[model samples]
Target: MDFRPLAHFTAQDTWLNDPNGLIVRDGRWHLFFQNNPHGPDWGNMSWGHATSPDLLTWTRHPVAIAHEGPEAIFSGSAVEQDGRVAAVYTSAYADGRQAQSLAWSEDGFTFVKDPANPVLDRGSTGFRDPKVFRYGDSWRMVSVEADERTLLVHASTDLRSWTEVGRFRDEPGTGIWECPDLFPLRLDGEELWVLVLSVQDADGSRVVHRVGSFDGSVFTGGPPRLLDAGQDFYAPATWTGAPAGRRVLLGWMAQPTYAGATPTSPWRGAMTAPRDLSLARVDGSPVVVQKFSPEVTAAFSREVADLPPAALVRCGFDGDASWEFRAGPDVLRLAVEDGSLVVDRRASGLVDFHPQFARVDRLPLPAGTTGFSVLLDRCSVEVLAGPLAVTQLVFPREPFDELRTGGSASARVFAR
Candidate 1:
């Protein structure tokens, strides 16, 4: 049940939170993260970097950026500008106000602050976490402006002088849309741009992205589309393609409450699988779907079942177990009872966890109940149940990794 820690990714680490700059340079994939050196809590947020030629084999680099600048250097993006790498970020100052700052890196690892510190700080009290991009002849910035009620878009040609271009309200009538991301997407053969945010409303919090158009000066678009069904996903941002291509994405896995909550490991909070995104045929709508990165599939030590639709198969994976099964509808399910186990799979892709965790006192099933492709990586289980994904942990806290059912138990794969 033990796992070899991912090279750039950690399991024995404390709080590896936000996915910072995710981009491809020189035919290489670069991943930067906001990591807390402290255990499971959001503290000193720094940019930790890693690179990969192929996603499977990751190479960890230095602690790219630390908490030396105004308070903790929050999340931001890096881009190649003027023949050098320049980063734009929301700098958290000690007074609790945010200022947008620029940094330049010639080597892509070491970043030096721009001579014009706080280049565009317009006293947007909570102005932090700046996302900058190049659009045609101008550079654009989408940032959280007011402390709680506003979002702002600015236009600048030199990443220095900034001019307010658009304003959006996220009041209760709307929602507290945290990270405002404005980008372009192709849907059903239509050329369109989308504005997205990490939103919190009366119901709860979710990742929301919307369609909007820029008519020379202003943005006009519909409301956001609630993207993630998982209760745990948040702070998603898009990236420019690698070598040169389409739009990509990166998101932090840590929720506000889950920040620093899990136990310390070689890695703490991890991203959901790195996915290749595109406007595709999703149940008839032009929705975005994640085609699993090859690296995600490469992690499977034992691939038990690759069942087609409505196929069910069970096997006794006695003792300690770790596996990833490509399930179908009814979907795959695995249960544990009094340290024993059960697995249920349905035909249309819904998963039940009650029987799977019966051994753990048969915890009541939460609402929005559905089937899932249970990814059991040691004590970590990621239930990918369509849009609603849930991650759970089970630490044995005993002298064995084996489930305590008369000393052993069994698990199998089933397709309803």
Candidate 2:
């Protein structure tokens, strides 16, 4: 079976993980990620580079930041400050020590390491993944103490010197937390901060977010709720420098449970399409809602009856509904029941290669949710409805070709 994704962001031939150094500079979107330059499995952790005029089509460039001697570059964020692009990342040493470091570029493509590197060091192996942004009269940073499941918040006046101001710890951790993002959004003229984190354990990995208030030094928030219920969404980060009022996010679309066992060679991971995030009221409480960015929606705007290898299948219903996409003997099923959107891929062909590959994923939808959209690629499926998202990676022996609806369900298939 062919596994090349046409509409998703993937490395041409390498392993990729958390997206790093995401920013828009000089009218182009620059995407950097945790990449293994040598092979298809994760190692030689350097930053891979790519640029996009729009978020849908990407052009690959040379490795942006490579490992130096005993230090490997890890995940981080980028900003265009004071007429240059600056990146603040984690420099992980060979002896299991990690510290925050700095790199800068005059031209967004080539980078120069700061001679005075590792501007911030905690002397802890678990400290890494710094995400920096502009704040009042200076800059602010949020990095993770991974094993401790705590977020370390720091402030800097010139991107080099940092002072620890506040910290937020997730209680009784089930796993280590990594790749956090803190940003603000306005809803109905009220401003609220959103914190997104990726948590991983032996069971699997999932993304969660909290809505709260950040007062430059401390973030006081409410309970943590899932950002995505799907088994494959993790390590999401929003790009800086978007048009005013737009917060665009992208995530690595693979889970830790079966990432090593995926059948794809030369490339082992892909990114979810860019999601446009906003806030809306649900049950009288404010929650984050995700919709396909305009670029992605325009790519899959053609309507069809037979499912293509890459397409978007949209379904609408009044009450209970069910839909199926069948190709030969394999069938992938979807249904709405018990206030949940269910995606069943247990019978979607190639499942035996990894025991965890075949499963049912469910996302709870809002009460008035009458429709949901599924983005299909050669090897994955992402379901979105209102503020609910369920992303799963699937491997079928053959591509699905037909869409069938039942129980008051109606469907419209769109292909690029």
Candidate 3:
């Protein structure tokens, strides 16, 4: 099957993983990612750059930060400072030591490593993935202590010097925490802090998040919850300087079980389509609501009659809704049943890559959600329903382009 997606961003002839330094500057979106320059498999990690005026069409740039000595450039965040773009990332050393590093770009395409590299180091073996943001006149960063399962916070006046301020302890989980991100979401005239982190173990990886309050130093939260119910969403990053003062996010759409086993040669991984994030009241409690960005929706102005293998479709319904896709013997079903969003891929085709790829994943929808969007590609499906979104990777032995719907709903399909 042809696995190329029409709307999602994928690196050309290389491997792409966790999103890094996602920021909007000068009306363009700069997306830096954890890339393996060597081959389709994961190795020789560096920061690969791409710029898009609209999220639909991406222009790939050269490797911004090449692999240095024994250290590989890991995931981090980006900010616009003093009319220039600065990237703070984790440098993973070959000896198992990790430290925070800095790089700056004037054009947002080419980056230069700082002379005083390794800006912050805790001398801990598990410290990495620095997420930097502005707080008052100083800059704040959050890095994960993977071995200890804690988030270490630091403050810096200058990007070169940093002081440890506070730490966030993680709740019980499978493995180490990676790619820690802390941001504020406004809900009911109150701003709440949302912490996102990825958990990895021998089995696979998943993203978990917490909604709470964060003072200048410490983050106080009760417990964490799963960010996405689907199995393939991981290592998500939110952009700082987005248009119209919006918080946008993109997640890596692959899992550890069969990430390297996909049939897409010369390119290993792709990103989930960009989603606009906001806080909403779900059953009287605040939850993160993810919807397709306006930029993505605008790209699908031309409507088509049927759902192509690669298409963008939006569905609206009130009480109950069900959508089905079939190709030969393979079938995939999506439904809102009993106030829950269910994605049944048991018969979606070609599940031999992993044992858990052929199961049904369900997530509770908001109390009054009546509409949603579905972005379907050849090998994956992303569903944005009310306050929740799911990204799942699938493989069909044959391509499926037939779509059917039930209940009081209308489907508008678009192709690029």
Model 2 C-alpha lDDT per residue in residues 1-416, reported as the tens digit of each score = 87868788888889999999999987798999999988899889999999999898899999999998999999999988788999889999999999999999999989999888999999999999999988888899999999999999999888988999999986786679999999999999999999998998776788889988999988888788888888888899999998775899999999877787788897889999899999887777778899889889998989986788889888899878899877788888889877788889899888877877788877678889999888988888888898888888877777877778988798889999
Q: What TM-score does each of the candidates earn? A: 0.72, 0.98, 0.94
Ranking by TM-score: 2, 3, 1
Model 2 is weakest, by summed lDDT over 10 consecutive residues, at: 355-364
Hey, what RMSD does candidate 2 come out at?
Answer: 1.2
Off by over 4 Å in 2: none
Q: Residue pairs in steric clash, candidate 3?
A: none
**lDDT value for candidate 3?**
0.85
lDDT of 1 by residue, 156-232 (tens): 98888999888776434544657767776676677666676776666556677655576534667665555554445
Lowest lDDT sum, 10 consecutive residues, model 1, at 398-407
lDDT of 3 by residue, 368-414 (tens): 77878888888889888766778888777777778888986568888
- Clash count, candidate 1: 36
Question: Cα miss at 358, model 3 (Å)?
Answer: 1.8
Better of 2 and 3 by lDDT: 2
**Candidate number that wins on lDDT, 1 or 3:** 3
